[model samples]
Target: MRMRTKAVLLIVFLSCLAGCGSREPSAQSPQAASSSHADSGEIVLEADSLKLGQIRTAPVVVQAAPWDEFETPGRVELDPNRVSHVLMPVPGRIRQVLVRLGDAVQEGQPLLIIESPEVSAAVAAYRQAQAELRRAQSALSKAERDLSRIRDLFANRAAAQRDVWAAENEVAQAQAAVEQAKAEQEQARHRLELLGISPNEPVQQISVPAPTSGKVLEIAVAAGEFRTDTSTSLMTIADLSHVWITANVPENLIRLVQIGENVEVELAAYPGEVLRGTVRRIADTLDAETRTVKVQTELPNPSGRLRPGMFGRIRHSHGLKPVAAVPPAALVQDNEGAFVYLEKGRGRFQRRRVRAGQPRNGWAPITEGLSPGERVVVDGAILLSGK
Candidate 1:
């Protein structure tokens, strides 16, 4: 009887074990229930996992594209039209330098005085020309009187017709000599005028004057320096009231920037200062290696603050257009690049790579990938990113 009772108890225990195995297992805990499919760029979580992570989402917005902007490296340059190089007209020793480097001078102001033999030579030549002219005029007057006498003699049959012709030829030759003398005098006078000397007064000295109103940028001559090369530059001047800002823009973006468009310039030296400029010129050819086009902008520099070779950037707008944007928390940046978490609904999210703009007004403008009205994990994005 004891044996039969033990067998019945064992069967009952076996039946209970079979029932426990057949029933459904208990649900997994929150941490264990979460899954991340990195290969598919997706993440899924259970309701408990979502609640514990405190994930929150918001809809992406449509706004003006700060991404529709253009910027390129630029530099300040001197306008070629406003620059002047002073060259002496004749070989001379600099007697006195009236202006120093960096001195502002007006047009026609004397820059230096030169004691040149050329000036004295020009004066002597002019006096000689004057004497020649006077002698030629006296000869012409005598020839005219002789021609009149010969005509009267021919009319009275006292002189041959050939003699009258000879006298007329003499008068014509005298007139030609006078004309040549006058031309020589005029040329000499012009030469003296070019040397900045009055033709009426003979002088051994000449004053070189400024060609334009500008500041002296360079001076190659001193008070006692002798310069024999007349064609070489003795000094340099430039009008600093205006300047040019040149940029090398990518070829792909060349179409977007047109001549006559307005732009803003920011210099690396002056961090916060922004100056206005206008597009003035565009190069016809592209740089083969860089695939860039040269662009120039004219900028007013009345204050003379802009200097050549200063590093800067040229910025321009492409007009307002709709662009996707999100809060700062929604964007994630890593070694790969920038990305964001998009809500796929039902506690599911996906990673989307994007091109992002600099943050502004509490939002980051999306230049690529994301679209308007899409939902993104604005809060707890870091948690999803780790997964």
Candidate 2:
């Protein structure tokens, strides 16, 4: 009887322990259910929460607006027409590099000095030619005087006619020599001018001047380097005040891109900033490999912020088309895809999946899963997305 009574008390205590374990899970079931409900794409916020989150809503509408222009990956390039290639004018040893790479220079500014014996040789030839010309002029004057004196003697029977003829022939020969000498001098002077050296002061070192005002983009030689090729470029200068944004547009869309059409450019470096430009040129032929036409847009970069080789996008407006569009603030993204919150009623919003088209001018066109006349959370959609 005592063992039976102890076993019955033990069984009753075990049952009570099991009952408490089951009640603990039942007590926590409501919290799990509430969490699952919150994640069901439905968000209900009170007036205070809406104001705190600054959530604003607007009605979706179908409107005739410029279609969102598609973007093509492009790079910022220096305008080819504005670039100046500083080439070596003569084969010589580089005496001094007056300007370094990226130096700003004005027109006719001396960029570098080169030591060349050619300039000295050219100058010496010019001076020699000048001396020969002077001597020839003196000889011609003396010959003319002798000819006149001989002719006067012959008329007075003081000299033979042959002597007079000989004097005149001598005068003609001297005149021809003077003409030849003058031609040689002119040729020598022209050579000196072509070499960018003064005929009067032919120095061993020649200074290379900048042809245009621009920033130095490249340097191919250093001081003391011997450059033997005049055809090769020594440096490159480009005007960065304006730049070209070269974009490859598809052949189908090439018609939409005309010369002088205005465009908007966006660079990754400057987010949210739209740089305005105009189409300056369009390629006559399409690229065989890319099957696209190269479109060049010119933009004024007065601040020099736009740099060469910068990656950016070019946007141009097509004609107006009817589209279901919403403000950019209404769009939100998640692991699944982009979405927007639909207003079911006051303080009630449901997450709705959407396919968004290219955004333009602060508006995004909806391609799918949204209709006109529906209210969508614009400003505060991000807050609901977090919930």
List the RMSD of every prediction in angstroms. 4.8, 10.1
Off by over 4 Å in 2: 1-57, 62-64, 135-183, 318-323, 329-356, 366-372, 376-387
Residue-level lDDT tens digits of model 2 in 195-239: 789876748888899989999999988999998888898899999
Global lDDT of model 2: 0.87
Question: How does each model score on lDDT?
Answer: 0.88, 0.87
lDDT of 1 by residue, 1-387 (tens): 999999999999999998877663543344334433545567877777745368889899987764347789999998888999999888888999999899999999999999988898898898899999999999999999999999999999999999999999999999999999999999988887788787677778889999999899999988888899988998999998999999999988888888999998999989878899999999999999999999999999998889999999998887766788899889888998898889988788898899888665678888899888999988888777666
**Off by more than 4 A, model 1:** 1-32, 36-61, 65-69, 270-274, 325-337, 341-351, 357-365, 373-387
Could you say which candidate leads in TM-score? 1
Give the distance in Å from residue 249's predicted Cα in candidate 2 to where it truly belongs: 0.8
Task: Give the clashing pairs for model 2.
Answer: none
For each candidate, give its TM-score against the true structure.
0.78, 0.68
